[model samples]
Target chain A: DAGVTQSPTHLIKTRGQQVTLRCSPKSGHDTVSWYQQALGQGPQFIFQYYEEEERQRGNFPDRFSGHQFPNYSSELNVNALLLGDSALYLCASSTELAAGELFFGEGSRLTVL
Target chain B: AQSVAQPEDQVNVAEGNPLTVKCTYSVSGNPYLFWYVQYPNRGLQFLLKYITGDNLVKGSYGFEAEFNKSQTSFHLKKPSALVSDSALYFCAVSPTLAGGNTGKLIFGQGTTLQVKP
Candidate 1:
């Protein structure tokens, strides 16, 4: 089965610009969660999308938003990007919303200049 | 809030020697702990998790982690480390929410494991 997949393996954006990163959950999975991993740091939870609605969110600002489609694919949108927004965006998929093992994609590397 | 701490920023070990990456967690109720490995420019790969039952859980790549409830620590171990075992290791904890289990993970700063030849 195909694992989690993410688009725009690498992306470059300017400050004040908006960027969207896409993700397709693993086969047979429905829940999608986004995470941000900064250099030399572990990933920080961004938010989770279930049933086409945001179910859980982390401490991120309003600039960070996400959407889940009926097909279980997800998109993470970052508005007014800052230089500090440069990081690896990881998308994880799980079979359920409860405690379960997560399968991750290769991730989209966002470089905000 | 749930959190994890990786005490060592880096760990050096020779090939053929056993390796251990330390991790400690803080959370209320039953803590669901996990270990993930990340290669350069890659996503985090699930190694193992400790939900309940056996304290020792074995995972892919011959990796094993011991869950110590008393110490609130889960250390990853490998018996004969290889050069390819070098990678960034992260420990995470899933907080049991009052609403329900969200499976949201709180990760540590991460530790770099350098297995030398």
Candidate 2:
């Protein structure tokens, strides 16, 4: 059984540009959540996707959006990236929307130059 | 509102010694607590969780956490530390599953644990 997987393990972008990070949730999982982990900080919830619709979001602005495909894969898009956007973008998958343990992917390291 | 705090920024311990990473949390109803560890550039890995029942929950990698409801704490512990145990640890809390919070998780600032040889 494969665990959660993420694409573009590392990427570099510049200000004003947009970037999309991909994530494939663990098998048998349906809900996916995205998190942003800045240097020397814990991962912060970005948003959550369930039933192909965004269910909940954190303090992030509108620039940060996400989509959950029918297959339970997810994509996190950050538009007009700023230098502060440089961080590790993590994806976690859970079996349902209720509280439970989450399986995480290695994450995509985004560097907004 | 639900939140968590890791009072220590860093903790140092020698190999073979016991280690503890402190954590405290606040929530409206029943608290769902969790601990995750991160190794350099990697995503957080779930270590253990406290939902109900036992106050002491044992998890992978010889990790165990004692959930104290009165003090509102969930501290991670290991019987014997290993150099490889050095990493960043985070404590998290989730609001009642029945509440509007849904699957949201609020993480602590994170504490760095260094198990020296």
Candidate 2 lDDT, B10-113, residue by residue in tens? 99999999999999987878868899898976778889988899999999899999999999999999999999999999999877755544677889999999
Candidate 2, residues A1-113, lDDT tens digits: the string is 99999999999998999999999999999999999988877889999898999988899999999999999999999999999999999999997744757889999999988
Model 2, runs deviating above 4 Å: B97-101
Query: What residue pairs are clashing in model 2?
Result: none
B105 in model 2: Cα distance from truth in Å?
A: 1.3
Best by lDDT: 1
In model 1, what lDDT does residue A54 have? 96
Please, what are the lDDT tens digits per residue for candidate 1 over residues B1-117? 568999999999999999999999988988788999999877889999888999999999999999999999999999999999999999999887676666899999999999999
Best by DockQ: 1
Q: Score the docking of each candidate (DockQ).
A: 0.74, 0.69
